[model samples]
Target chain A: EPEVTQTPSHQVTQMGQEVILRCVPISNHLYFYWYRQILGQKVEFLVSFYNNEISEKSEIFDDQFSVERPDGSNFTLKIRSTKLEDSAMYFCASNQGHFGEAFFGQGTRLTVV
Target chain B: AQSVTQPDIHITVSEGASLELRCNYSYGATPYLFWYVQSPGQGLQLLLKYFSGDTLVQGIKGFEAEFKRSQSSFNLRKPSVHWSDAAEYFCAVGDGGGGADGLTFGKGTHLIIQP
Candidate 1:
């Protein structure tokens, strides 16, 4: 089955450094999303993208965070200045259409020191 | 706002025993409910989803869930569970559709299978 794929299975960066997490959604998918789960916490939605732009975002998706569909197949999340609290497992997902079943990537574990 | 609650933090069941995981949802309108399983250090794998129609929905791996509107609950059940079933299960709720459909997930229920 086709699946979403994320790069950098694990990443460790300094607290003040910038980091980029990349994802390649399913080819036919129209909607893409970014979610993060802190250790022992629930998965939280960060942002949703469609038509190459952000469609919705949560309060946790603040100024330090940004997402882009840099290419037709590549979706990325960039953190301008990572904080220690930013450490989490970040997952990328995509679906073909509205409310469709979404497939998730293995996730990128981002650890900020 | 939409939210999901998985009451049990952990559940232990013997292999070959029946299993059930509880989930409750809070949403203003018709909510899209989903069940996902996550093995340690793995990604979220969808088990099943309840959008509309029949309240009882069957999922992969012999798992099924019943959506009870009156109770605002969607509970997952399996007639027989295997040792591989040991994992963390999450219940999630989403909005109608489109790009606005960001899923709200519960804290998750960790399932432990006794051999």
Candidate 2:
């Protein structure tokens, strides 16, 4: 089965540093999303991308966060300034359509020190 | 706004015992419900989804869920859980707008299967 893949299984960055997390979604999927889960917390939606632009985003997706499809098959999330509270497991997901089954990546653990 | 509630923080069940994880969701219109499992150090794996079919939906790994609209719940059940069933189970609800939207996930219930 085709699956989404994320790079840098784990990352540790200093506070205020910029960090970029990369994901390669399933080839045929049309929608991509980024979600985060703080330790012992529920998974929270960050943003959703479609047609090369952001379709929807949550309040947590503030100015410090940006997502891009820098190139075909690559979706990236960049945190302009990482804060200690930014430490969490970030997951990338993709689905073929509105009602299609979504597949998630193993997740990139971001630890902001 | 959509939200999911998984009341149980942790549950321990002996091997070969039956298991049920409770999930309640708050959404308007008809909500699209889903159950996902995450093993240690792994991503969320979809167990099943309920769209507009029968209230009872069967999923992989011999797991099934019943969607009770009256109770606003979608509970996951496994007749016989194995040790490998130990993991975190999350219930999610999606917007029924037929647009590409993110899912609202519950806090998740940690399943501990004792051998």
Docking quality (DockQ) for each candidate: 0.70, 0.68
- List TM-score per model, in order: 0.98, 0.98
What tier of docking accuracy does candidate 1 attain? medium
lDDT of 1 by residue, A1-113 (tens): 89889999999999999999999999999999999999999999999998888988999999999999987989999999999999999999998887688889999999999
Interface RMSD of each: 1.6, 1.8
Candidate 1 wrongly placed segments (more than 4 Å) = none
TM-score of chain B of each: 0.96, 0.96
* CA-based DockQ, model 1: 0.70
How does model 1 score by TM-score?
Answer: 0.98
Per-residue lDDT of model 2, residues B26-91, tens digit only: 998899999999999899999999999799999999999999999999999999999999999999
Using lDDT as the measure, the top candidate is 2
10 residues in a row with least lDDT, candidate 1 chain B:
B93-102
Residue pairs with colliding backbones in model 1 are none
Q: Given candidate 1, what's the lDDT at residue B21?
A: 100
